[model samples]
Target: MQVETLVVVPVVLVAFVFYLTHNQTGLPRVGKSGPFGFILTALKSITSFADLLDEGLNKYGSKAFVVPTMAGSLIVAGPENVDLFKSSDDTAINQPISVDESLQLMHTLNSRQLALPFQAVVVRTDVTRAISAFIPEILEETRLAMAEAFALPFGEKSTTLPLFHTMTHLVARISNRAILGPSICRQEQYLHDIIRFAETLSIYGQLLTWFPRILRSPVYFLLSSAFGGPKEPARAIIPHLKMLLAEREQGLENAKTITDFLINLAPPEEIADVKLLAMRVLSVNFGSIHTSSIFGTHALFHLATLSESELDTIRHEIIEALESEGGYNKASLAKMRILDSTLREVGRFYALGVVCLNRVLIKPASLVDGIVVPSGYNITIPLKPIHFDENVYPEPYKFDCFRFSKLRASDHTDLKYGFTTVEKDFVPFGLGKHACPGRFFASMELKIMLSHLLLNYDLSLPGGAKEAPKPIFFNSHVIPDTKACVILKPRVGQAGQDL
Candidate 1:
C-alpha cells in the first residue's frame, strides 16, 4: 500500500502540472501550434537559449520568440529595442525580480530602508548634479591613491602579481579615497575589510537567490549567524563613517568633500541616519571595486600580452597626450584613442555579463509581428550573441586592438547613437539611463593604474607560460583563470619619469 501510494502521488503531481500548464492561457504561437507541444519544445530548447536567439535573429530577422524559462514565454527585440528600452514609455518595463536570497543577503548587510533606498539616487537629476560636482575632487584623490598604492613594497625590484589581486588593491584604495577620503582610504586594514565584506555578501546573495522568497529571510539569518554576520567586516569601518557623519553635521558650514555633498542633500530629519549612510558607502564600495577591478584587470592583461609594436604605439600615444596636456586630465585621457580602443576591445570580447540588460514585463505586450510576451515575464538581451556576431564584428574571435581605431580614422568622428556616445560595437558599461554612473571614475582609476604600471614595469607571461590568459566561463560570466600569471620587472631607465 505504501509503495502504491508513492507511485500514484508522483504520477498525479506530473499530471496536475501538465493540466495546469496546458489549460493556462496566453501562450504565444511560434514555429508550432498547441500549448503542451510548444512547452515541451521550449523545455528542450531552454539550455540553448543563447543559440536559439541567434538562430531566430538570423532566420526571422531582428525579433525572436523565447521561453524565459520552462513556464514563461517572451518575444525579444534586437538592438533597435535599445532606444525603446531607454525611453520614458518603456519605463513600464519593471526592474527584474532579484533573487529573494540575494535580497535577504543584502538585508543582512543593510537595513531594508538602506538596501533599496529610492532608486532616485541612481536614476534622477539631483544625483547627477552631485556626481558632476564631485568629479574633479574624486579624480584628484584617485590619482594620489594610485601613486601611493603603486609606490609601496618600496624599491620596486620586479614585483609580479595576479591581475585580479593587483586590481582589487588598486581599485579598493582609489574607491575608498573617493568614498571615504584620504585618511581612511590609506589605511590597509580598512580596504581589506571592505573587500572581505563585499566578497562575503556576494557569496551569500548568490546562494540565497536559488531558494523561494518565503524561505529566504530565515535562511539568511541562519547562514549569517553561522557565518559571522555582516558586522564581522563592517565593524572596522562603520564607526568611522558614523563619526564622520556626525562631524559633518556639527560643522555643516565647513565640509567640502562628497560626504559633505551627500549631507547637504539630506533633510534635517534624514541627517541622523548614520546606519543608512554607512550602507550607501558600502554599496558604493561594492559597485566601484568589483566592476572596475574586473575591467581594469582585463585591460592590463590584454596590454601586457599584446605585441611590443602594439604596446609601443599605445605608449607613444599616452606620452604625447601627457606632454601636450601636461597631465592625465579628462581631456588628455580622452585623446588616448588607441588606449580607449584597446579597453573597449577587451570589454567587448570579454563581454562583462553573458546577459546584458534585464527587464521584467509589467504589462502584456506584442513585441514584433506575431510574438507576444505576457506580463510578468523576465527578459534579457543575451550579449554574447550580439557581441560575437560576425556581421557586426568581423573576425569576432580575434583580438584586434585597431578595430575601433580603424573606424574612427575612416569616419573622422566618434561613434554616436542619438544622444548616447559610445565607441565601436561594445556596450560593456551598458547603455542608456541605467548605464553605470561610476564609469568616469572607473576610467580614471584604470588609466592611472595602467599608466603607472606601463611606465614603471616590464610585464610578460612567465617563461614558456602560455601566451594568453585562459578565461573561465561560469554561467555566462567570464573571469581569468587562477592559474594565469604575469612577470613584472622594474623599468631600467624610466625611474626619472615618475610623476
Candidate 2:
C-alpha cells in the first residue's frame, strides 16, 4: 500500500501540472510547451532572461504573451499595454499579491503584517515628508559608516573590498539610523541578525518555488529546520522594538523614527503588536537596504570606469554645490546635477530586474487594443527593452553619464530628467500609483553616498578593468557582482570634513 501510494502521488502531480500547463489562455505562448517545457523555460529565464525577453519581443511585438516558469505562467505585456499599470483599482490589480506570489512571502515571511498597509503608508507619507529633516543624521551616518567600512588609513595607501557586501553593510547601518534611531541601529548584533533575516527570507522565498505547490509546505518546514529560519533573526529585533514602544507610551520618545510613524499610522488594533511591528520594520529594511545597496554599488562601479577628466567633472560639481549651499543639504545635493545623472544612468543601464510593474489580476481585465486577460494571471512589462528603446532614448546602448543632465540642460526640464522621475520608458522604480514610496528617501540617500565617495576618495576597479563588472541574472532579477573589488584611495591632503 505504501509503495502504491508513493507511485500514485507522483503520477497524479505530474498529470495535474501538465493539465494546467496545457490549459487554454488564448495568448501567444513563448518557449516550449511540452509536459516539462515549463521547467526548461524556467532554467532559461535564470540563465538568459534577457535573451528570453528579446525572443518574446521579436516574435510577438507589442502584444501580450505567455512565459512559463516554476512558479507559474506569466503574461509578458508589451509597451502598448503600459497603461494597465495606471489603473487605480487595487482589488482588481494588486501589487502586494504579486509580490507575495513571486517572493513566496506568505510562507517565507511567516507573518501577517505583510498583508497590512502600515509600512507603505508610513514610508509614503511620513518617511518621505520627513527626509529633509533626516538628511543631517543620514549624512553623518553615511560618513562614519563609510570610514569604518573602508578604513583606508590617512595616507596614499588604497583599500580593496567586495563592493556589494560592503555596500550592503553601509546601507543597512545608515538606513537603520533613520529608521530605528541611533540607539538601536548601530547595535552590531541587531544589524547582523536583521541583515541575515532579509537574506534568509529572499533565499528561502526563491527556494520554495522549486517544489510543486502541494510539496512546498513540507519542503519549507524541512528547509527551515536545516538552515535556521527568518524567525531567529526576526525575533532578535523584538526586544529592541518593545523598548521603543514602551518609551513612546511613557512620553520619553518623540515621533521621529520610522517605527514611530508606523506606530502612529498603524491601525488601532495592531498598534501595539510587537511582532507585527518588527515584521513591518524588517520589510522596510529589506526593500531599502537591498535596492539602495545594489544601486550604490552600480553607481560606484560606473564611477570607476570613467576617465580622470570625467571624475574631476563630477568632483568639481560636488565641491561647487557644497560651497554654494554652504553645506550638504537637500538643496546642495540637488545642485549636483551630473552626479544625479550618473545615478539615473546607472539605473537605466542595469535595472534590478528585466521586468517591472508586476501585477496579479484578481478579475478579468482589458489591456491595449482591447485584449482581455483573465484573472489569476501574473502580468509584467518588459522593463529592459523599453529602457533600451532607441525611439525614446537616442543611442540607448551607450552608457552616457550625462544623458539626463544634458537633457535637463537642453530641454530645461529639471524634474522630468531627475533620478526619481518615472515614465513608461523609465520604470526602474515602477510607474503610476504603486511606484516605490521610498524613492524620495532613496534618491537623497544615494546622492549623498555617491557625492561623499567622490569627494573623499578616488575609486577604481582592480587590475585596471575598463568596464564595470557584469551583472549576474537570476531569472529576471539583476544582481550586482558580489565578488568584484574596488580600490579606494584617500585623496592626499584633501580634507573630507568640509563636505
Candidate 3:
C-alpha cells in the first residue's frame, strides 16, 4: 500500500501540473516540447542560458517563445513585443522586487531595503552628485592599483598579467573608494572579501533555489557566507556601520558618502536596525563593484588592441581635457568623448546577457493578438539578434571604436544613437523608466580608469598582435579570457601622475 501510494502521488502531481500549465500553457518552447522536455531544457538552460535562448530565437524568429527553467518556463518576448515590456507598470509587472523575490533576496538583504527605491534615494542621486569630489581619490586609487598590479612596466619591458583579474582588482579598488570610502577601500583583507562577494551572486542564488520552501531559510543560514561573499563581511561591518549611524544621529556628520546617504534614507520603519543597514551597504558594494569591474575589464581589453597612433589620440584627448577643465572634473571626464565611445562599443559588442530589462508579471497581463502572460512569468526581449540587426548597427558584429561618437556628432542626430543613451534598439543599460540609475557613476568610473591607463601606460597583446584577446562566453555572458595576458609598458612624463 505504501509503495503504491508513492508512485501514484507523483503520477497525480504530474497530471495536475500538466493540467494547470497545459504544458506551459501552450507557449511555443525553445528546445523540446512537452512535460518531460521541460526538465531537459531546464538543465540546458542552466548550463548555457544564452544558447538556449538563441536556439529559441533561431527556431521561432520574432515570435514569442518559452525557455524552460528548473522552476518553470519564462516567456522570451520578441522584438515586436518590446512595448509590452517597456510600458508595463509595477502593479502589472515589477522589475527589481520581482526578480529579487524569485532570488530569495529577502533572506539575504536587510528587510528595510526590500522594496525601497534605491534609484531615487541612494544609488542614483548621491553618487551622481558627489562623484566629482571622488575623482581625485579615484585617480589616486587607480594609479596605485595599476602600479601595484603591473610593477611599472617600462620601455620594451612590459608587465604581463591576466587581463580579467587585474581589471577586476583595479576596478574593485576604485569602486570601493566611491562606495565604501578611502579608509575601508584600502584595507587589503576587506577588499579581497568584497570582490569574492561580487563574483558569487549566481552561486548564492542557485544554492538558495536548490532547497524546497520549508528548507530554504535553514539552507541560507547554513551556507550563508558560501553563497554571497558579503555574509561574513556583513557581520564584521555592522559595528562600524553602527558607529557611522550613531555619529550621524548625534549630528557629527561631516563627509556625506554612500554610507551616510543609505543611513539617512527614510525607510518604512522610523528607526532602522544598524545591522540591516550594514547589509544594505554590502549589497550596494557587491553589485556596484561587480558590474563596474567586469565592464572595465572589457574596455581595457578593447584598448589593448588599439594602434599606437590610436593610443596617442586617446591619451592626448585625456590630457587636453584635463588641462582645459583644470583637472579631472565632470567636464573633463565628459570631454573624453573617444573613451566614452570605446566603452559603449565594447558593451554593445560583448554584453554578458542575451536580454535586459527583465520584468516578472505581478499579475496576469494581456498582450497584443490575444496573448496573455499569467502571473509569475517573466517577459524579456530577444537582445542579441536585435543588436546584430544590420539596420540597427551597420556590420553589427564588427567593432567600431567611434560608432557612437559619430552618431552624437551627426547633423540632426538623436542622442539615443549614442551607446550610453538606451533606446528600443539599444539597452546595454536597459531602457524606459527603470533604465540603470547608476550608469552616470559607472560611466565616470570607466572613463577615469581608461583615461588613466592611456595617460600612463602603453598597452598591447603579448604576441605583438593587432587584436585584443578574444573574449570567452559562459552561456550568454561574454567574459575576458582569464588566462589571456595583456602587456603594459609605462610611458615617460607620467610616473607620478596621480600621486
Candidate 4:
C-alpha cells in the first residue's frame, strides 16, 4: 500500500507540472520543434550560455523569444527589446527578483535584516563630496599593497606574479581599508579569510543557481549546507567584526566606516545582534569583492600590454594631474583622463557579464507595437551587441584606449567621458533607476589602484604584448585569466616601501 501511494504522488506531481507549464501564456517560444525539442535545446543551453545567447540573437535579435525552462519560458532579447528594460517600471518589471534569482541571495539573506545601508554610505560619503578626504589614504593603501603585499623590488630586481591572485590581494587590502578600518584591514588573518570567503561565495553562489525550479529547494539545502550553513561568510569574518561592533556598542569607537553604516541600516530592534551585523558585512563583501577584482585584473592586463608610447602618455597624465592638483586628491584622480579612459575601454571589452538589466515581470507589461508580456516572465537585455556592434561603435573589435576621450573631444561635446559616465550604449555599471549606485566610488578605487600601478611599476605580459590572454565566460561572469602572470619592476623614485 505504501509503494502504491508513492507511485500515485509521483504521477500526480508530473501531471500538475506539465499542466502548469502548458498554461503559461503570451511568450513567443524559441527553438525548433515542440516541447520535447525545447527541453533538449534548453539542456544544451545550460552548458554553453554564451553560444546559446548568440544563437538566439542570430534568429531573434530584434524580438522577444522564449527560452524554455522547467518553470516555464523566460523572455530573452537583444538590443531590439532593450526598451523592455529601460522604459519599464520597477513595479511591473521586478529588479529585486532578478537579482535574487541570479545570485541566490534570498536563501542566505534574512528578509527583515537585508536593507542596503551601504548605498546610503556610498552616496553620503564616497561620491563627489566626501571621497576627496579619502584620496590620500587610498593612495597610501595602494602604495602599501605594492610594497608589502606585492613586495616589488626596491632596486632593479622585480617579481613575476599571477595577475588574478595578486590583484585579488591588492584589491582586498584596498577595499577592506575602505569598508573595515585600517587596523582590521591590515591583519593578515582577516585579509586571507575575507578574500577566501568572497571567492567561496562566487563558487558556491553560482552552483546554487544552476538547479531548476522543481529541484531548487532541495539542491539549495544541499549546497548551502556544504557552503558552511548560510552564515559562512559572516562566520569567517565575524571575529574581526565582533570586536569593532562591541567597540561601537560601548561607545569607544572614534572612527566610522561601512560597519557603522551597516549598523545604521539594521532595524532598531535587532541592531545590537553581532551575528546580524556580520551578515550585513557579508552582503557588502559578496557584492563588492568579485566585481572589483574582475575589473581591476582586466585593466591590469591591458596596462601590462600597453606600448611605451601609451605608457608615457599615462605616466605624463598622472604626473601632470598630481602636480597641478597639489598631490593625489580626488580631483587629481578624477583628472587622470588617460588612465580613466583606458579603464573604460577595458570595462567595455570585458564587462562583469554579457547581459544586464534583468527583470522578472511581476505585473503584466505592455510594449509598443501591440506586444503584451504576461506576468511571471523573466526578461534580460543581451549587452554583447549593445557594447560591441559596429553600428553602435565603429571598428568595435579593435582596442582603442582613448575611445571615449576622443569622443569627448568632438566639437559640440560638453561632458567628458569618464569611466562612470553611463549612457544608453555605455552601461558597464548597468541601466535605469536600479543601475549600480556605487559606480562613483568604484571608479575612484579602480583609478587610484591603476594610477599607483602605472606610477610605480614597469609592467609586462608573460610571453609578450602580442599574446593576448583570453577571458573565461561561465553563466553571467567574464572572468579574467586567473592563471596568467605579469612581470613587474618598481620605478626609481617610488616612496611606498616604508609605508
Considering every candidate listed, which one attains the maximal lDDT? 2
Tens-digit lDDT track of model 3 for 114-140 = 566553457777777888887787878
Distance from true location, Cα of 12 in model 2, Å: 7.8
Q: Which residue pairs overlap in candidate 4's backbone?
A: none
What tens-digit string does per-residue lDDT give for candidate 2 at 1-499? 6999999788967865774475356888777767577667866766787788888889988788887765667788887667767663668777878878777767766446446766888899999999988999998998888888889656638999899988888888999988888877788877787677665666677767666677678778887787766666566567777787788779887788887887787665565667766777778888898889888998888889998899888888889888999888888988989988988987788878888888998887888778898888888888756888888889988888889999999998879999988887788898777889998999999889888888888889989897889888877788789899899987856744337
Candidate 2 backbone collisions, by pair: 46-475
Q: Residue by residue across 1-499, what tens digits does model 1's lDDT show?
A: 6999889667755654454244232433243446566556455443455555556566656664454334345445565455445542444554423222233434555544333543225423344444444445555665565455445366656556666776787778766765667777778877777776665565566555434444567777887787644555466556765676667658745544444445555544445666565555666677677777777777777777777677777777778877787766666667677766766777778855556656667676555344566665555555656678799888998877677777777778764321124432456666665566666656666676676567666677766352467666533356665556666775667632443
Q: TM-scores across all candidates?
A: 0.78, 0.93, 0.88, 0.86
Report the lDDT of model 2 for residue 321: 89
The true-versus-predicted C-alpha distance at residue 57 of model 3, in Å, is: 1.8
**Descending-lDDT candidate ranking:** 2, 3, 4, 1
Deviation (Å) of 301 in candidate 4 = 1.5
After superposition of all CA atoms, the RMSD between model 4 and the true structure is 4.0
Question: In candidate 3, what residue range of length 10 has the lowest lDDT sum?
Answer: 16-25
RMSD of each: 5.7, 2.5, 4.0, 4.0
lDDT of 4 by residue, 1-499 (tens): 6999889668855764463345265555655556566665555555456776777778866576676543346677556656557666678888877776666665645543224444445444444354665667777888887777557555548788888888888888887777776877777766776777677765555665444455556766776576544454465457766776688779887545666556555565545576766766766766677788888888888777778788878788788888888877777877787777777887788788877777888887765545777887777777778888788778988777778767766733534477887777777787776677667767888888887787778888876764458888766567888898888877776533122
The prediction achieving the highest TM-score against the true structure is: 2
> Model 1, residue 459: displacement in angstroms?
1.5
What C-alpha lDDT values do all the predictions have? 0.59, 0.80, 0.71, 0.69
